[model samples]
Target: MATFQIEGGHQLKGEIRPQGAKNEALQILCAVLMTDEKVYIDNIPNIRDVNKLIEILSNLGVKIQKLGQGSFSFKSDALYLDYLESEKFKEEGSSLRGSIMIVGALLGRFGKGYIPRPGGDKIGRRRLDTHFGGFIKLGAKFRYNKEERFYGVEAPNGLKGVDMLLEEASVTGTANILMAAVLAKGKTSIYNAACEPYIQQLCKMLNSMGAKIKGIGSNLLHIEGVEKLSGCKHTVLPDMIEIGSWIGLAAMTKSELTIKDVSWKDLGIIPETFRKLGITVEKVGDDIHIPEHKSGYEVTSFIDGSIMNISDAPWPGFTPDLLSIILVVATQARGSVLIHQKMFESRLFFVDKLIDMGAKIILCDPHRATVIGHDFESQLKATTMSSPDIRAGISLLIAALSAKGVSTIHNIEQIDRGYEDIDGRLRAIGAKITRFD
Candidate 1:
């Protein structure tokens, strides 16, 4: 395990280029299993989850080559799907939720797939019912062996597309079905699907590879099955979640940080949501500059002309993954704001740690909380803490970095699973942070 030791109250000032989208890269990497042609991917983030996924692919006989920084070429000319029964396969596949998508891609290409129970942040009960439901709708038969904790799926007559509406707008579920549908027979109409930026990027990349997909950015998608797909080069988009993390880090540390090459158009309601917390983000031609001044910061209201309660939804709304960071930033702002994390029940449990650090916050419920900025200047005593999830881990890091004294954060592997060289990036901006093994 690794820990981050931070000397707090240092203003971070510099420009940082955000990494590629982790979610998008994982989906695209799995999509490579659908074809044996060479696929080149650029701007892939160097994170633990991605490396683990690559290892899984290599074990399956997929040849991967690292050409340069953030660039790689992958070819699956001789993939072996039977490796799913190996202990190495189960161990690596169970480490991240994204591994579940491998089932769809493998089944699409090889007509059979097997995987163990996937693992990820224990935020709440993240059900795989939607994913398997979508697979079943595509003419795949699924069976689970609880004693071995493994699930298998087979498509004998090949996947036949059908019209179906997802019970929940699950992101991975939509991606799984879309990948399977791309190589299926007949047209697939997916209504009430998740159309997040990652899904849209997946659709675009598949289209570039000869897949016919309509309604790229909407919930309703029409995928026409293609007989075959060839290799193509695609660059992953900059991570919007990471951009949100940087915004929170800049505001909490009271720093003048400039984020470059950000996809500002993809930031649907992020700027407006941050403005509510009294943070003014300036757009300078593909760059977002956060000035280092904190005198007149106040929470802005909603479009209905009332005090807004920020919450998470499926898409085109504030992301559930970023709500923790937003809550942390609210502690240093000028006014009160309500954070409603409707997607997860235990995400707000970290507010107790913030409360111990002299932050004025009230935990309204498991799903909602009201934070009143105390602006407390006292030194936050050094304490030992464990990370809960990816976003919460980074949120705690931001709080520890902005505190008055040194704080030790344990289980930094959770943070590393997402952010690439986080300490190095923060150090470049004058953040007094160190990592210890």
Candidate 2:
């Protein structure tokens, strides 16, 4: 295990470029299995989950080459479908939830797929029922063994597309079914689909590869099955989540930082959500500049002409993944704000740590909290703590960096699962952080 030691109260200042989207790069890599020709993908973030998926793909006989920094070219010449049953496959498959995507790609290309139960942040009960339900609608039969914790699927007669309305707006579920539907025999209409930027990017990539897809940014998607697809070059959009993380860092530390290559158009309600907490971000020619300010920023009211209550929802709304960081920033703001994390039950559990550090917060319930900014300037006593999830890990890191004393963060691997060289990048901007085993 690894830990991060931080000597706090340093202003981070520099121009830091955001990495490629981790969520998008994972599915894009899996999409290569849908085609037989070579594909070149640029701006692939070098992170643990991405590297793990690359190894999994290579084991399935996909030829992968590192072209340069955050670039790769992959070709799936001969895919071994049965390799999913190997020990290496099972080990890698159980490591992350993204591995479940291989199920859809394998079944689309080879008519058979197998995967063990996937693992990821223990936020709540993230069901795979939507994914399997979508696969079944595409003419596939599934069998699972609870004792062995493995799932297998086969479609010998080829997939036949049909209309599907997902029970919930699941992002990965939408991507999985969209990839499978592209090669089916007929048109597939998916309603109540997740239309996040990652899903939209996947649709765009598939369209470029000869797949006919409509409704790129809406809740409804219509995919026309294709006989075959060829390789094409595509560049991933900048990671909005990473950009949001940096924004939170800048606000919490009261520092001036400029984030370049930000896809401001794709930000949707992100900038608005942060603006409510009194964080002023300026957009300058595709770049977001966060200027230095005092700690006690004011909270803005809602559009209905009332006090604002921020929450998460599907696309075109605030993302649940960012609410954790938002809460950290809210602690230093001037007014009270309500945070409702409707997607996950346990995400608000970390606020206890923030409260212990002298912030005035009230946990309304498992799904909501009311935070009254304490503006505590007294030195925060450093303590040992373990990271719980990717977003929460980064949130804790931001809190630790802004605290007044030394703090040791354990299980930094959770943080590394998303952010790339976070300590190094933060250190380059005058942050006092060190990583050690």
Off by over 4 Å in 1: 302-306, 376-382
- The TM-score values for the models, in the order shown, are 0.97, 0.98
> Candidate 2's residue-wise lDDT over 284-358, tens digit each?
999999998765568987678775699999998889999999998888777789999999999999888877766
How many times do residue backbones clash in model 2? 0
Clashing pairs in 2: none
Best by lDDT: 2
lDDT of 1 by residue, 1-437 (tens): 89999888888899999999999999999999988899999999999998889889999999999999999999998987678888888888888788999888877777778888999888888989988888899999999989878888899879998999999989998998899899999999999999899999999999999999999999999999988888999999999989999998998888899999999988888877888788889999999999975663677777887765889998898889899999988887777889999988988998888887778888988999998875534434455677888999999999998888888899999999899999999999899999999
Please give the lDDT score at residue 208 for candidate 1: 91
Candidate models: Cα lDDT each: 0.88, 0.89
Query: Candidate 2 regions off by >4 Å?
Result: 303-307, 376-380
For model 1, the run of ten residues with the poorest summed lDDT: 374-383
